[model samples]
Target: MRIEMTTLAEQPVAGVHICFFTDSLEPSGLGVHLLNLMRWLNPARYEMSLVCPDTPGGRWLMERAACVGAVVHPLTVRDRRDQASIDRLYHILTSERVTIFHSQVGISWEGMLGLRIAHRAGVPVRVVTEHLPYLLTHPGQVAEHRETTRLAHRIITVSEGARRTFLERGYPAAQFICIHNGVELPPERPLGEAARVRQELGVRPGAPLLLTVARMTWQKGHSTLLAAAHKVVARYPQACLAWVGDGPERPQLEAGARALGLAGHIRFLGQRDDVPALLGAADLFVLPSRFEGHPLAVLEALASGLPVVGTRVCGLEEAVADGETGLLVAPDRPDELAAAILELAGNSELRRRMGQAGREQVAARFTARAMARATMQLYESLLCEALGRTDGE
Candidate 1:
């Protein structure tokens, strides 16, 4: 089906309506993805309607979102039907005349159903953003992914490393694109006064400070990072580690730290919104996650000009240039991780150089504007292709 063009008071637009069908817009990576995209998109050219399950955060955010002139539709989703999300999504597509459908995390069974619905409604195109390597998530979803990709006009991956995983899983390269996760850069961060944050964190001057910003989960590799810190402190006794997030795995990880006699060396700061300031005080940043697609924390670290040390996993490899921008070691290797951290912590030159290099990488390729521009261009291309129009003539 061809998308209808809309006429405004002064100009005409392609009349593209985007429908982001997700389970909910709670405090998660996918929610962040939705909000960030809405923030960066060109409002004059595109219209958006977010279809999600009812979530918290009051009318403050929703009211503010409406003030900006986008539509938010709440859904009462039930996961028991034959692709109920997909079925409901079809109704929304026809109702809103959506030109694009974007879904996050894994392919929702209902999400695939929705895509099929939109396609059948003559919406012309569908899009899916894979935030993680999902080839191993569920066998049925994997099959659905194949079918959806075959039907979709385009597919987006958060990282190049993740794109490779999809290709390995037999996803067609012809329809795939890499639009790395983009975040709004704070206008100005006075990284000067670290005294207050440091005092609050209870670290004396010249004490080696290491920081991590992630949820407490098995994939985050907090357990292994803690083990690495144990050996790190054994070599450099004054070193300390601070974590800035909480999750289901926190209690168990805390117990493991106690068992390893690292209770004092590690500080669980829970969740904090002072990440920008926290990155300023830290000497080194570390994220030894076992798996990832594109970690926003790593991006924040690099943007803050902190030297990051993470594992050689999906998405990370795309942002961190091995031994150039940041150090990448094999996951679950506390010994190698410890050595890499020691190398950065002990040498101020390597830390400064890598930190500078990391910042340059972020500026060059990972800006929010860049990500949004590429996404809009892709959406337009898909729309145009479905409309039987070639680029510009």
Candidate 2:
């Protein structure tokens, strides 16, 4: 017997061409989210292309996107306001016959510029995703937000908290959509060598292990985590804290850990591809972000069957489901953070229950398929409205 498979290119699509632009493809949450979106989106319903900066990270993104059947392009967009860059982007938009231009607004200055170029190119629909909410206190950021909002046909926020912030600041209510970030559920059985991985990380076989996977940036609250680690070790001498991911604050954070005599108990593991195994070998997951825009790490931790202890910030607030799946503490409060970690650490039963609850929550609400479906629905709505306007014309 012979079987035939339909490739994405051979399928009839909705004829809506969308080009997604990003700053770089560094191994960040945004990159991971984008990759998942490309993979899950119904290729039979729309055409997709990804444009990123011409850099190593951009090349990495291109390769990943290509693997998922997305057409990828790398462009040299050095400055947002540079006429040359704008001209190049405009040319690409026109040449590709792009119907919609989608991007994340705040991360790359060129994103806003791309929106303007798309508008000028007469693209019927333009969508921008806001992954982080900017404070209204900053006049410059507020101005930039307004400009980006005016240029886009719609704005997508990763959480309701982010949407509320923008609405309160006078952005049009109808223009915003809150779509929570999602993750693929972990395997039914743990995939990695849990015990061996823990031993390699210098964690004892039977000691409690706490894991945090976040860039060492000020916004991520590493300083507060370090302080909390000090209190954790004092209470449980055998406990070990592993810090994954790297950033500018690594030196300072490492120094703080040493200053507090936590060098032995704290391990800076840097970035690793084996995140699932890391979570499996751990007793709990902690995220001390001062703020967030629907962190994928929390969802991954939940899916990994690990109880999360994160700051009571926007996205985390929704992800944690406080007291159900995990605990939430005030941002920047190391003492409170320490107390929460200890609360989970001391009780194995509580940890196990919370972990089970978290896994259930992720499976129920936050899956990569859900995120892609919501996005595609939004795209269809805009495309229909565009068609309606053209018919009236």
Best by lDDT: 2
TM-score to native of every candidate shown? 0.87, 0.91
* Residue 180 C-alpha lDDT in model 2: 83
| Prediction 2 global C-alpha lDDT | 0.81
lDDT by residue (1-393, candidate 2, tens digit) is 011222222222357788988764353777788887888888776688888876766777788888988788777554665677767777777777787788854352336666766777777778988777645556775687587669788889888998898888788999989988888998865455788888898887668899999988888998998888878988889889999989889999888888899999989988787888888889999999998888999899999889999999988998899998999999999999999999999999999999999999988999999998999988877876765533244
| Candidate 1 residue-wise lDDT, 229-343, digit = tens | 8788887777779998888899998998899888887899986768888888899899999988888888878888889999999888887888887799999999999999998
Every candidate's lDDT: 0.75, 0.81
TM-score of 1: 0.87
Span of 10 residues, lowest total lDDT, candidate 1: 4-13
